[model samples]
Target: MQIQDLLKRTDKLPNVPDVVRELIQLLNDPNAKYSDIAARVSHDQTISLKVLRIVNSAYFGLARKISSIDEATVLLGMDRLKTLVIASGFASSVTKVDGIDLPEFWTESFRVAELSQWFAKRTESVDADEAFTIGIVHNIGRLLLHLTAPDVAHDIQTRVSNRQASRFKAEQDLLGFTSQDAGKALMDMWHFPKALGFAVQQHKRPFADGDPDPLACVLNLACYLNACIRTEREIDLVREGLPMAVIEAAGLSPSIVYELDDAMAVSDGLGHLIH
Candidate 1:
């Protein structure tokens, strides 16, 4: 089936809030004021409470607690405040879907997001917050597929697990499009930044073109690193196992992957925001 057909049956998917939609519009607006953003967030008590909860969480490691939306905006800065708002808002909208492990899914997504931000900071062309946001949303199409077609999703997963086909190949065979295709369609429907949608579409094959999109490259590396972490692979192996072209594409050194692995080790429990 086409991506549009699946999206047309999105009754089980999360309904993005109006405030979240407005916040997303402001996401790419260079002229957006922090005061206005704070006011908007404060107006939505649900999002406001979640933002405060996340900012005050141990993940941020702030010295003192923040009590107000204005203070949150000031402390987080516009970029990060925007990231938090988008993350919390989108995350809060998600309802339970069948045939998926919500906690496990979010845990991986959060790790990838943190790693994406880390890679973005080191890459000259990528925006760290944008990378983080994309990382969180990269797998949403898979979730959507699970919601709309659990039987097909299950078969695809089983095919990959049984070594019958790669996940992408299985998706292409079964659904006529990869999750990335569905994800980009969803992002377009949500009116997210075009670059963000492009990054999601290209992440699995960041170097498909002669010159890679830096955000896509960063996200690809983040997913790679996150996989290594999940499998508990040795740092030396991770460094050696990664392709030299992939490392260069993200403008990172092999040594930093070790550092990131150690950092990720201590970054547990941060995925609470997803629940």
Candidate 2:
């Protein structure tokens, strides 16, 4: 089916729960006061508990434990707090998708998100938090595909495994569209920033021509590198699409890309925070 058809099907798609959606809107609003956000978060006892648990986890490496949501907000800072809230909230919703194993997907997704944030910080392309958030949400399309068309998603996974084809190509061949297409459509339906939607859409094809957004290029490279390491599949087709201009724009090098694998090894401790 075409992406437009998928867009029309979004009403049937799973969404962030109402409370979580309101929290996201509040967090995204520039003029939102902390007291209002805190109150909203407080209203959801389960979510608040998860957020506190994550904050106190090894990821933050806090000198002392954070015992309350208010303390977490104070310690994590607004940017990190918002990221944790969004990540935790989304994780709860997305983990429930049937026919897909959540643990494996979470491992790869969290690794990509961590790596993307590291690259963004190293290259100074954007705030590390913003890059991390983008990295976490970038593949949300794949989750949607699994929800809407599990059979097609299985076919795509098989093609990716057996043929070593790029995820984008596998999805296109099997379903007449790609995760990026579906992801962009979902982002649009949710009224996400156009830049973020574009990043998700074009992440697999960074140098597709036009005014290239540097942030998208960063995420594109991060996703490419993550897939290269995690999947046994050879990805020459995916590699060839990485443009020299885009790499230059991000101020990254082959050496840096090679080092990312080792850097990720050190980040294993941070994975516990996402639980």
Question: Model 1 segments beyond 4 Å from truth?
Answer: 61-65, 253-269
Estimate, for each residue in 1-275, the C-alpha lDDT of model 2 and write its tens digit.
87666657654475665555664455346787766677777777877888888777766789998887777777776767676776676677654666567766766777777777877777765656667767877888888887877777788888788977877778877778778888888877877666677888887777776767777888877776676666643445445544567677666664564454454453534345665
Model 1 clashing residue pairs (backbone): none
Against the correct fold, how does model 2 do in TM-score?
A: 0.81
- TM-score, model 1 to reference: 0.91
Best by TM-score: 1
Instruction: Compute the lDDT for candidate 2.
Output: 0.70
Find the 10 residues in a row with the least total lDDT in model 2.
Answer: 261-270
Q: Give candidate 2 regions above 4 Å deviation.
A: 7-12, 18-32, 231-244, 251-262, 266-275
Q: Extract clashing residue pairs from model 2.
A: none
TM-score for each of the candidates? 0.91, 0.81
Q: In model 2, state the lDDT of residue 200.
A: 82
